[model samples]
Target: MKRLPNFVQLKEVGPRDGLQNEKKWISTADKIAWINMLSESGVKEIEFTSFVNPKMIPALSDAREVGKQIKREPGVLYSALVPNMKGLEFALDAGIDAASVFMSASETHNQKNINKTIDATYPVLDKVIREAKQAGKLVTGYVSTVFDCPYEGKINPDQVLRVCENLFASGVDDLSLGDTIGTAVPTQVEQLLEVLMKHYPKEKLILHFHDTRGMAIANIMTAMHYGINRFDSTVGGLGGCPYAPGAAGNVATNDVLYLLHGLGIETGIEEKKIQDAGLFIQSKLGKILPSRSLAYFANAQ
Candidate 1:
């Protein structure tokens, strides 16, 4: 392989994106402890929680409280998903460093997931991103299902660019593409990355993938092959989108870091610390870790 990017931005999504869809409900204290541990693990950015309706995603209902209680480390960017103006306000008032405003590239998935047409969502996201910008809070744009959708499979590359253009025009600080259903392979990832690179600089994009079909890490390397260095990962592989059916588990934090480490990519994420953090949350959720890297370390000890 040719040379990959020099530095990678690894964002820990275990607390918000990871734990939200799990069957068991974790306590607020445990959530705080998990976030703090990951912060100390040298991850510079983290999607901490979502500010959605509690009745809908009860998993993230305590987002405001989580923000208030958790300590923010210097140089660490902690963010939450804000579906609209309401969520954005809560995140900003709670002292969140940044917030994500998102929609899907697939129309059917967008409707099924958020109950809004993709066109309708653009306006909402525009309002939220503009508000966050005025508040001096960093904002990220999410384009889910850029690779493919379970409901509407085989999304086109142009669709990804159109959504990204909407997000960038809305004044988003960055754009993150999600293979929400884990149906993406290296070829599709390369195709989407090509379009994104044509319209977006490498610094402006982050890749989010689930391991439903056992291809998440491989897809990450594919993105890296195309010079994508920023990615979303959940510790112990503890993430799935509630909206993406059959999509479970994100790429593990240590797994990606270990790969980057071997490739001499500077990710700034500590392996042992992330491992300990994963063990802590796994014990709370009371389930076996889905990450092979975490499992290997646990067995070794």
Candidate 2:
């Protein structure tokens, strides 16, 4: 008998991860408006933007202004990706409720994505994590490329364990494991979780999967059966890793909700509202998004 949780926790990363890779610049006002729309959509947490250097991610260059201006609801936890202490400062100044630090599980991918070796990257993350905690903000550590790396293929679960251990020890409240290049299948997810669950509680682990090969939903089903309930998703499957070549968008939040709700698993999120928010962002981008559920809901209504 497979064990699936009665409820699931979904973190909305569409505002940050979904938009970071796009070439067209979404206006600051539009970003703010879209986030405000999502705030009413019943998601508990939202990674609204990143505090990276403006030159690095010009799409989210208005992180500070967007963070400051969004109509924050009382129950929503507003979070941002903080790459360093400097970024942490900016995020803290913008009053983010949480700070997310990140790195890749593959050493080569870590160096390529973060521009620093895995060992060297820890101290920087440590400082950011410590300061964010001291400021009374929650910290989430994201480990990218946990399953496979674009440059270094087929990542060993042990490598991911090492990275996760250090991040958890450094005081992250939880770790979001990434299938960065979207190469993970159900067996691989099960294998990796078998290794990881021994050292870390399932509650402390959140799965972040990209739907590059149309396997994210399958992998997610495996995770759910293994008693994992938290996941990171983009609103309309809008995302790609600039550092991970050929990586596709994240698993769509709309689709995930459809799956969970259809299974009688509770997410406490309205699928129609989520699809509407997806449609809003899709229109702003002037492009059709990749979320099948969003497309279906849009057409149905």
Q: Rate the local accuracy (lDDT) of all candidates.
A: 0.86, 0.92
Candidate 1 residues lying further than 4 Å off, grouped into runs, are 240-248
lDDT of 2 at 149: 94
Best by lDDT: 2
Q: What is the lDDT of residue 156 in candidate 2?
A: 92
lDDT of 1 by residue, 55-164 (tens): 88888888889999998899999899889888887898888888888799999999998999999998888888988999999998888999888788899999889998
After TM-score superposition, the amount by which residue 219's alpha carbon in candidate 2 deviates from its true location, in angstroms, is 0.6
The lDDT, on a scale of 0 to 1, for candidate 2 is 0.92
Model 2 C-alpha lDDT per residue in residues 1-301, reported as the tens digit of each score: 5978999999999999999989889999999999998899889999999999989999999999999999998899999999999999999999899999999999999898899999999999999999899999999999999999999899999999999999988999999999988889999999899999999888999999999999999999999988999999999898965455545599999999999999999987888889989999989987778889998887887
How many residue pairs clash in model 2?
0
Q: How does candidate 1 fare on TM-score?
A: 0.96
Candidate 2 residue 101 Cα shift, in angstroms, is 0.2
Q: How many steric clashes does model 1 contain?
A: 0
